[model samples]
Target: MTLSTDNALVVPHPLGLDYHISLQTPYCILCRYAVRPGEIIAAVFGHWGSPSYLAYTLGFSFPTVAQFEYGATVYEKSRSTSYPWLFCRRSDCYNCATLHDTSIYHIDCFHIISKNTASKRPSLRDIWTIASWTESLPKTRYQAPPDITLGAVADETLIDDHESILARVCSIPQELRDIIAQRCPESPAWRLVSALSRWRIFQPLLDPDIEIKGFSFDDIKSWCRRDGMVAGSGGSGKIRIQLDDLGVSRLDYVNDSPALPTAASRSQNAWFVVEEVSEMQEARIETKGPFMRIHKLPSFHLWDTPVPPDPALTRWNREITGNLRILRIRSIALKDITGLTVFCQHGAVRWIYPHHEETFPGPYSYPCDNSPSMAQLVPSAIESSSVIAIFFPLAKGEKISSVWVRRCEPYDDSIPDTLAVITTRGRFQLFGKYLCPTRPEVHFQQLSGNNTATHLLFQDVDFPFQRVSYFAAVSASVNNTGISPLAPSQLAQSRGFSWSSSFCYVSIVGLENVELIWLFRRQVPEGTPERDRLCLGMMLLYEDGTLAAAGNCRQGPDIDVQVIMLPGSIHYKISHKAGGVAVECATLDGGRDAILGDEEGWQSIDMHSRSEMRFWFDDSRTIWITSPST
Candidate 1:
């Protein structure tokens, strides 16, 4: 017998396993209390008639039946002193299941209510509606219309086409053929069903008014006969017809029906028609814009300069390649430092880390920690360096002490002559150490529009001096003609020199808030014809992003920033503040110079060029030599 879609009963019990089984078969019970709706119970032993069954067969009153079910009985008593017969000692509650059992009494009445509850059944329409609404869907069915089309359907061909897939299914491997057959059975063109199943793909079609009529297996067979090709004959004299490529191509068309338009599709004037309600339910809306949102700008990678090797410069060549290692050190003392200053010339200014202990630490002093506070530079000019002078501040009763320089070898081993010792009357005896530079290159000062010209002075030495050479160029930034001050003969006052250690000074004709960092190196060692050791130089910080650097010779893995040429004039304004410090700057043409304006304000710095700047802060004390005129 065929299962009717309607009239399908659903047991009310949450777990109705036994009740379902009983519906499928038959069973007997002892009494109403013998079993629950969903519980399993054994049949009576050797008894064909149960309590209720026996009552129905024996014509007993409801109360009699109930008493028997409870293992009770009735008897009549004799004369006036006694009953005619012996009656049941236990009283019987009438079975409310029948009218004869009803009485004017306070009874639970729940048993009667249960009978009515059990009799109430669900209608065929309700079952069908619920099933349609709550059914789970298969994956192959489209749940929504995708913004970007699925790759599978993009190249699909019409089934009616001779070369289409329906025809090709027969030629495909048995496994693939079986998979397709299981998915799309040759039956009713249930486009609505398919559409509803793919709700995501056809959500716009979701409406109470939408109706889909189902078709029978015979109807599908006729459709297949008209469209699909009969591939072979079966064992039972039946024709085994396979959906040809042409027939399959026409399947979607045949199933097509009016579809509700999606918001996005409607805006774009797009319309579609699908066959099954399920297919319509699964329909999706497509947006015209991008499939995925793209949100940020591409980043740029900076290329590092290659380092050259020179045996003569070995003493100043301390750097770890490809590693930014963290090191621990002591904090710099303010008393042992000197020459803590900010100078401005032309349209530029820089805090110079000259021989000041805070500016440049020698070997004997304790190593100071280089941190964020020590290396911050803002309103930066070209190649700027901030030097802090540290020395022991004289105390009322404390006596001054002697200070010495410390030294070390390549392996961090102590070298007696690494630094020089000195004596002062202040309570603190140690020297100063500058912390950081602005940026790695001299690119900054040029941006501020400063002149970069310098004259160098050096010690006369022999072969080693001859082995070393120097070059200089200058930029005046006048008439929009970028003539740099770095040229060897840019200014008559500018000095140039060649020896183990060198020095030079350039004037900034134009450019504001400018700074200069001087590069210094030793080409010769003591006892030798030349003195190849570390030297000391100076750098200025600018308010603008530019920086300026000048000195004897710069070291490798240098952190000093470089200046780039621009097409404008630059100038600076310098002012002296209280406490022996000054603000040196070459802001813009008419811009005011930037420096410490008040006697009391927290000053932070830029350590952008700290790598090279750190050289001055190191214990070696040899990045720059003294100026000849000084």
Candidate 2:
């Protein structure tokens, strides 16, 4: 068959680039099942037959013309049965005794007959026979002249050429070919060609003829060491050379992370171990990253020598050795001497002494050498007119050892002068040749004396202080205040009461008089007795002189008692009396307020979530909380 010149190969689209590859067409078949092109054509023509009528008038089969139709199948079913029925069935028509649709099938049948007519053209081989010229013949014997095409050249001469059919081979160099013939006599020319081609492709890097001279044994050895040939030398341990030239020693790590020397026998010539530390002037620990390294300082000091050594190494031999002892000695006063004692009634006081000018130097010193003072004596001052008794021992040498005293300070807002006088003994120094080995204990005695005596003698004996007491009472409902019989029925059925998960409660308005008594005692005794009976401390008399009490009466639950601060120090009795519980006050400390664990009481229920309690204050001269409101 003759080839068609009109249908050339499909070239890529001309985008600005010289060569281009087309984008892959998406395969609808691969992604999902889809209707065939024939089905789609049938559906479109069957629905609208404008193109089908044109095909019939043009003498073409409707099926063949519909091949180029552009449409998609709308409905899904067996297209084979559906399409044929649509094409064959019509209003009225008969073919081969069977009625078929003429209107629909006319256009598609015309194109099918046109394609069959085009297939009857002359073949290409028949035309080639009439135009043939060249022929071939074989020679059996006799010699003939070499048919060189160029020398006997003619416009249309037929030459028997074997170049296309015969196997071709590239000749190696004559010298190399002779050498191969002598050395590798078993190899054929084709095999030799193949071996050379393979060698060029696989081992193109085989010994190139580039001259490299002037390198001696020592120079090469030194170069190898510089390139990391020494054992345990470079950054990591392993040879730095290529694998092919790596002798017999297998490298542990042959990476490019900085070469290292190999230490195996086969690599003995490849590396050398330096017994001494190398002193290079440029050797410095880089502080570029997150860490810092301590590098050996250059042996040559900058002030002493300007230029560094040639081999530039460090003295790695010297190290600090042998026993090194640290001694710590503290010198203290050998003997105790007289010291001053002070008692202040109110304000705070502090005192310090300086013996002489600082004896030590530098940053650190004993007794704070940085703060030097020569002051030898100081005096006292008064914030208010309060008594202050001070006793001091007079020391001959002035080396005072210890100072002690029992002091009392009181703060009274009524008295304008609240602070007492404070006396301080200043610094003193004793002259001596040597410190005494034996330490003498000196005692300082404080006697009852007064700086402001008149104030103490005329001051009032008692002071007014705030006192708090507690009273508790329960109600059936949050806002209700009514009392009922102490029974389950009274608590649950009464209109004045309410019920909770655990208890039924009724309002107890009259039971709000539960009072609290605070009894103060210095200590708790083993058994109950008259001597242990605490006296009435402070009558927590509200201006009315009646103690405030809180009530706790709810539901059918009886009043539960909790021991407050001390044993019998504070006690309460709850009874369902007509008017409620009566409260009283008593003291267990005779005439004094409780020192510590003594006063105990309860507080009234805080309706608004705010409650308070009060008790006598101890010698601290401040009121204490007997009970807290709940």
Question: Cα-based RMSD of the predictions, in order?
Answer: 38.1, 48.0
TM-score of each: 0.14, 0.10
lDDT per residue as tens, model 1, 186-245 = 211112122212222222223335443333222232223234322221112111111110
Model 1 alpha-carbon drift over 4 Å, by segment? 1-630
lDDT of 1 at 352: 22
Clashes of each: 176, 39
Q: After superposition, how far is residue 161 of candidate 1 from its true place, in Å?
A: 70
lDDT of each: 0.21, 0.19
- Evaluated with TM-score, which candidate comes out highest? 1
Which number leads on lDDT?
1
| Candidate 2 local lDDT, 66-168, one digit each (tens) | 4322211111212232232223222121111111111111111112212223222111121111011000000000011111221112111111121311122
Q: How many backbone clashes does candidate 1 have?
A: 176
Q: Lowest-lDDT window of 10 residues in candidate 2?
A: 133-142
> Model 1 scores what on Cα lDDT?
0.21
Report how far off residue 219 is in candidate 1 (Å).
50
